[model samples]
Target: MPRDAEDRRLEPFEWNSEESVRYEVAIEVIGEGVAHYSALLNAAEAAGDEPEAARLRAEIGACVEERYRLRATDHEGVTQVLHKYRALLRAPGDHDA
Candidate 1:
């Protein structure tokens, strides 16, 4: 029997459980860190504060390292969230995703 188009189109959310929610929160933290780092970099550039910029850059690097360390030990839920966030970040011309 041919499946209904609507039924075929209805896909379950990849992360819909409580654990997934926690993972999502972690991913959001990582994203926020990225945004903060980017803003600091921009501000440093605008103000021509090379030293401050260097400091912020180091902080950003540390945050990234921490994120990866957590990810390495995270459960399946976190891994799923990380995968989705990475895909969105790497997507072209659409940062809102």
Candidate 2:
């Protein structure tokens, strides 16, 4: 299936906490790979290399699709985190503690 705009905007949190560092690195690598592939595809097209451009374009498309998929999953994860935190905040005993 195709990805939506929201899927493209989901961002991983920073690595200030040890528990999230690995996820941060993975997200960075996927993001960079997508960027690199996209740049190469554009450069090939600009150079009038139709064949090479087509190949690179396909590769970039695949990378972008994967990125979008990851973004969607991340968005869901973020939503869950927000819900969990909100619930904690609303707990009775935690009101002043």
Candidate 3:
């Protein structure tokens, strides 16, 4: 399935400027971390690995905190980036705001 540009995730290079670049990089990194940990958490849960799942959950929480921090300090339109990645971070049967 092809995704529309408006519906796609934000990239670091989409905005130009040193601060914007750094901000975007930080946001993207946090988003990626959340995604990676979420995947691992799912796998661990599927395998009944409680310890690993717990660790991954902590990591995902940290990423979410970082995402919130970045969003707090961002300029206009940063929520667009946040929502894009938040969708990826959300798990099945979970509804977080």
| Local distance difference test scores for all models | 0.63, 0.53, 0.64
Tens digit of lDDT per residue, candidate 2, span 40-70? 6678788998987777667657645554554
lDDT of 3 by residue, 1-97 (tens): 9988534544444445865675676678577767677877889999999988887788788667657655424654465555655565564533232
Q: Find the candidate with the highest lDDT and give its number.
A: 3
> After aligning candidate 3 to the native by TM-score, how far in Å is the CA of 2 from where it should be?
34
Backbone clash numbers for all candidates listed:
0, 0, 0
Provide the TM-score for each candidate, comma-separated.
Answer: 0.53, 0.46, 0.53
Q: What's the ranking of the predictions by lDDT, best on top?
A: 3, 1, 2
Q: Model 2 shows how many backbone clashes?
A: 0
Candidate 1's displacement at residue 72, Å, is 8.0
Q: Is candidate 2 or candidate 3 better by lDDT?
A: 3
Model 3 gets an lDDT of 0.64
Q: Sorted by TM-score, highest first, which candidate order results?
A: 3, 1, 2
What is residue 89's positional error in candidate 3, in angstroms? 16
Q: Which runs of model 2 end up more than 4 angstroms from their true locations?
A: 1-19, 71-97
Question: What is the per-residue lDDT of model 1 for residues 1-95, given as tens digits with 9 covering 90 to 100?
Answer: 89885467444645447756676577686776577667868898899999878877776786566555553235764665566556655665324
